[model samples]
Target chain A: MLILECPCCGVSGEETEFHAGGEAHLKRHSVGSTDDQFEEYLFMRENPHGVHFERWRHNNGCGKWFHAARCTTTLEVFGTYCAQTYEPPKEIKDAISARRPGWSWRNFS
Target chain B: MFEAVSALQGASFNAGIAEVRELGLRGMITLRGDLTDKKLIKAVKGIAGRIPEPRTVALKDDDGAAWMSPDELLLMVPHADVLSTIETLNASLKGTHFLAANVSDARAVFEVFGPHAREVMAKLAPVDFSPDAFKMGMFRRSRLAQVPAAFWMNEEDAFTVVCFRSVAEYMFDLLSIAAQAGSEVDAL
Candidate 1:
């Protein structure tokens, strides 16, 4: 039973209470964009073994969707933050880096 | 017969282990807005007598105000007063970026009252219903045996569970089975 603490509702519960959305922090492709860009945006996902970011909804709790930084291999969740932001918050990045010394996610190092 | 009838219609089971009854014709108003906004809070307070905190419920007589999500609140008022409540809310927060809808008939509410109420709930949901963790006024939207339901405890051994009107029968069937003979074990 994987547990996630919801940033919006402040309730921590098992995976049954949440819905997982694979791979976070991807650039959205829109109309008039290159075919390759559009295809990548629609189908591409980074299932990295080490540090990774994700989108999750506290579906059974707050009904809010948020982002989480976790290790794909170890399943070690560093932290969760607001989904409204374009990128992971600095604190979440710092938390990931503290555990994974050389790890980086998407645009944030 | 053009009269509206309750989903349960006085049908109950489990030999009084846990009694179930429908709260018929409840007036539900779905309010969506920024809870932190003073105007919104004041407007909600005007109807519910208090602003509910996150995952918390405030009860004033038969009226219940619950925080459904970060930006959503559910107000349960008397069936007769629903229209007036909506009008008052619209007048109160006239220019706010909010959505208010009357959802009275959209769902059905079942009240579970008995000593084994929490135990029966624990059998269906993945949440912990122990006194220390899940206590009074804590409202949560969770699945009860794959049916999306929301519940809140107003008394120590009593709770109110709501689900879509379409699935009320399925929900009752599941609960009835769970409350049947030999279901009351010491632990799950």
Candidate 2:
């Protein structure tokens, strides 16, 4: 079991109590961006093999949503923070805020 | 057609007393939304006729209790009242930002009562069940055997344990384990 550190609670808990969000720091494109740019934005994900920041829900515990920075290769969590306030990758954020088709928080936030 | 299941069978553990017979419990509804949503607040108030006072569980005229959470609440009412409650809520809600779903059938509840019930729960859950910490008319989101569950403690040493129906059987097994643990503790 992965021991996740909650930035809010300041405690490390089992991964079952938490959920993995996704790559952090997505950039939003400028308005009137082309379809190719939009497609690239939609399909491209930072497949980082090392430390990555993602959102994890403490659903079984505080029932509060938070973010976790962890290593996908090792399942080693580096840090955590609240989800809403956690900064997202500029591209992903722009796509999400733009309300573009295929852009979603569920797949990447 | 419905029968009351004992604590060891399917009883809800209360905090103040040993036990009280519960015929059937209300369906459990988990309402999730931003606490600052005025429209959501208005809708909930309209349906339940005012949310339960802060930190306190108040029942509707029909014996439904709305237990508040940090960002949401767990509402308990008779299964029969669920449909009407949802309809009234839908009519009152102004936006689609809020999500309200009836989870009564999704959860299995067991009422565990008795003076020792609290003690039994302390061993099972990580939260403080003492009156000061848990008190009367408070709800908690906690884990049982690492499974998500909502706990509502009412007066008379009575508490209701609600969890997903899929894990209800597992929780039941844990309760039996807790009861046996209680029994063992008593022996020593």
Candidate 3:
């Protein structure tokens, strides 16, 4: 069982308590945008091999959704943060950088 | 023309009552607010005898407040006190952005006790139920038999399990089977 720590409740429980909500920090291309842009918004997703960020809901636990920064290959959770924010915190990014040097994800380095 | 009945009212289980029993008609309320607010803390402390914290259960008078999340609590009282409890919480925490609602009928409550209680719970959930890990006053929200449920370790050998009313019967059945002697499994 994959253990996940809920930032809201502060409980680190099994994956069964959480629901993966796909990629995190996506820019929404909306109404006035071109069809290609809208399609990218709806269909494009990053399948990263190393450092990645994703959204997950602690549906069975605190019932709060949060962001998880993890390594895709090794499943090492760099950190977890509240989902209310638009981007992962700078310290979390720095931690990732310290572990995996010179790695870039989207706008973050 | 009708009255509400418990999920296991007429059902029978082979296991002894000392190990487990249905705690019917509990007054349950889902309370949401800012825990850090001084007024909110004092208000909840007035109601449940102490400020509730995440993963812990606090008792006030005869009521017990089980922590549901960072901003949510499950307050359990006698069935008759349900309405008044909501009113008290609202009155005490006025002006703050808070929500207090009675959900007494939405779920069923079961009390598990005696020597084999931990073994029974182990069969169904993945929670840490050992003495050092899951102690009295600690609560956990997780799945039991693939159904959403929450359980509180209320004492040394006692715990409370609450599940949706619709699936209460199934939950009771699963608990009964798990309660059988020697049907034990390891829980983390």
Candidate 4:
């Protein structure tokens, strides 16, 4: 019944066509060089309310992944943007890019 | 405007395929993008003159409806110029963050007109079919038998219902039911 606006498809379709991808901009922790440190970094989350980012998938239409921001209570989507272009907040981006004392994308990949 | 199909008179449906007998009345262009793209915004403004007002229909001089949003807008224009309009709008854009598509084939529309159109709508749609509740030239997303559709009344007694192509057959069935109900109600 709710007309969900798909950022990629450019149409207001039934919410059935879309699959909420959960919080959109969850940043991965920097590589922590050591095995124990990396494991801890891999599993952490701060599910905060009040202006949080979430991911949504256009499962029925374009088959693309995207991100959106919404109110936790009312489901008023404030903004939607492509996941590819998602620019995490400066603080989070910096924290992840720093790569701790010795971590990188290779360890997990 | 969808092509009017053979009406099943025994059923309660008034097919609006009559409206699409030629080309169609409304030419809908779908625009998708991140609202943050200034270039895209500027390009749309350059062509359309002004962006659609938020969550409302923005009508320019032409009989077009720009259903505005935080990210997407459906630009409805006179059906004849759909191809040209898409080209012009896309040409004006310098950025690659958005796509403007002429999806005339993807949707089937019903241009239901006449005095009893509202009566037929009541049975077809769940929302109040009153002129005051819907007003003229305003659209809302509703369903014709659980199918997603956009409905709006342009002039008094003239309503337009647009739905995706996949559900067109199902909608037509429901329209028949509503049309029959409309005639029955009129007799009373």
Candidate 5:
């Protein structure tokens, strides 16, 4: 049972109380974009073994969506932050980098 | 004029450890806005006596308010006062970006009263029902088995649960099963 804390409501609950909304920080490819870009936007996902960022909804609680940083292998959550950001917060990125040195995701290291 | 009816028409169950009864026709209003705004707080205070803290409730008699989220509060009043309460809130918060809607008929309420009432709640929700953790005034919105529900302690050995009217029977049955005789966890 993976436990996640919703930053919006500050409630820590099991995965059953929340809904996983796939990867986090995806740039949309709207009209006039190339078909490949659109397909990549819709289908491409990062399934990293460690230090992954994902979107989650506090489905049963606050009903607000937020971002979570955790390890896919160990399920060690680095942190959770508000969902209205384009990238993970600096503290979360620093926390991930402290544990996994020389690590990089998307643009942040 | 039209007649109003409650979801369950006052269904009740007794299972030795606890008694579950459908609380008929409660007035509920879903108010979404800046909880910290002076005008909003004053408007809510006029109805509930005070604004509730995070994940808590501020109640007085049949009227009170429960914090539902960062930007939402559930206002409780007498069934006959729902419309008037909303009108007052709207008039008070005219310039604010807020929403106050009457949700009385859209929901169902139940009461669990007994020595083991916390146990019955613990069985269904993924919450800490221990006395030290869940005290009076602390409200929680969580799942009751397969449905979304919110509950809070109203007395030392009693809890009030609220859920959508569509699942009133399901919630009642779930509570009944959880409070069934000889099915006690005896932990909390």
Candidate 6:
């Protein structure tokens, strides 16, 4: 029942219209990386109960992939942005921090 | 002489509330590039009347353009004019990174006409079909039931839907079922 808006085409649709792409902004470990780093890269994932960032595709709409910042507890969406960036934009981070103080996710706080 | 044939061979259905008719063959071009590029805009304007704004359509008679994405546009023209339109686009946008392909055969089009046309569309797609929300010239790309589809309102009582040709029968069935008699949701 989650209603998400595609930032690319500015169309809002139901969750059924989109495909969830799991976690977002994962760093890849290249060929020369250590076993621990590669294992962490492949296996480790953040399962935060509060604020989280994830990837979603507007599969039925514009067919563009975008990032969404939301809360796992209340299903409150902080914002959605284009997926072309390496990290969540500062405005989205600030918006999340404003609502949930002392919140930190990986390298972004 | 090669005879062109549509996927559904001109299917039509009357469900009391609306009339669903296959639009036969239509010329469609998938153009991808920078929408703001001057040459690209001019080339597309020549064919579709004008470049559509995001989530909108620019229509002039049988020719129109629907905004598919930030970098893509779906141009509609007469079936016989697809090849020539592509050639014109290629010549207009030479040396620029762009793509224009004939997708006329890849899609099936249907028109739903009646006073309750929006009701039929509202039953399947998860879109705001309220008169205030989905006005004329507004194009939407979304799923109709379980398959991918796109639609736009040509008039208050008419809607045009497009889906892959492989699912033309399915789309026709979906529309006909949604338009069945005594199944109106009069909410929007």
Q: Write the per-residue lDDT of candidate 6 for residues A1-109, one digit (tens) a residue.
A: 6788899989988899999999999888969999999998899999999999999999998899999999999888889999999999999999999999999999999
Candidate 1 vs. true structure, TM-score: 0.92
TM-score of each: 0.92, 0.60, 0.91, 0.53, 0.96, 0.97
The CAPRI class of candidate 1 is medium
Per-prediction interface RMSD in Å:
1.4, 4.5, 0.9, 7.0, 0.5, 0.6
Candidate models: Cα lDDT each:
0.84, 0.61, 0.83, 0.59, 0.93, 0.93
DockQ of every predicted complex: 0.71, 0.20, 0.85, 0.06, 0.86, 0.90
DockQ of structure 5: 0.86
- What are the per-candidate TM-scores when only chain A is compared? 0.93, 0.58, 0.92, 0.61, 0.94, 0.94
lDDT for model 6, on a 0 to 1 scale?
A: 0.93
Cα lDDT of model 2 by residue, B27-61, tens digit: 66777776567877776665566766544556556
Number of the candidate with higher TM-score, 3 or 6? 6
Q: Write the per-residue lDDT of candidate 1 for residues B80-113, one digit (tens) a residue.
A: 7989999998888898888889988888888777
**Range of the 10 consecutive residues with the lowest summed lDDT in candidate 5 chain B:** B9-18
Root-mean-square deviation of every model? 2.0, 8.9, 2.3, 10.1, 1.3, 1.1
User: What is the Cα-based lDDT of residue A55 in candidate 3?
Assistant: 94
- After superposition, which runs of candidate 5 have C-alpha atoms over 4 Å from their true positions? none
- Which residue ranges in model 4 land beyond 4 Å of their true spot? A1-109, B1-26, B34-50, B60-63, B181-188
lDDT of 4 at B158: 68
Better of 1 and 5 by lDDT: 5
In CAPRI terms, model 3 is classed as: high
Better of 1 and 4 by lDDT: 1
Residue-level lDDT for B180 in candidate 6: 86
Worst-scoring 10-residue span by lDDT in model 6 chain A: A1-10
Superposed on the true interface residues, model 1 gives a C-alpha RMSD in angstroms of 1.4
Q: Pick the candidate with the highest TM-score.
A: 6
**Candidate 5 clashing pairs, residues 3+ apart or interchain:** none
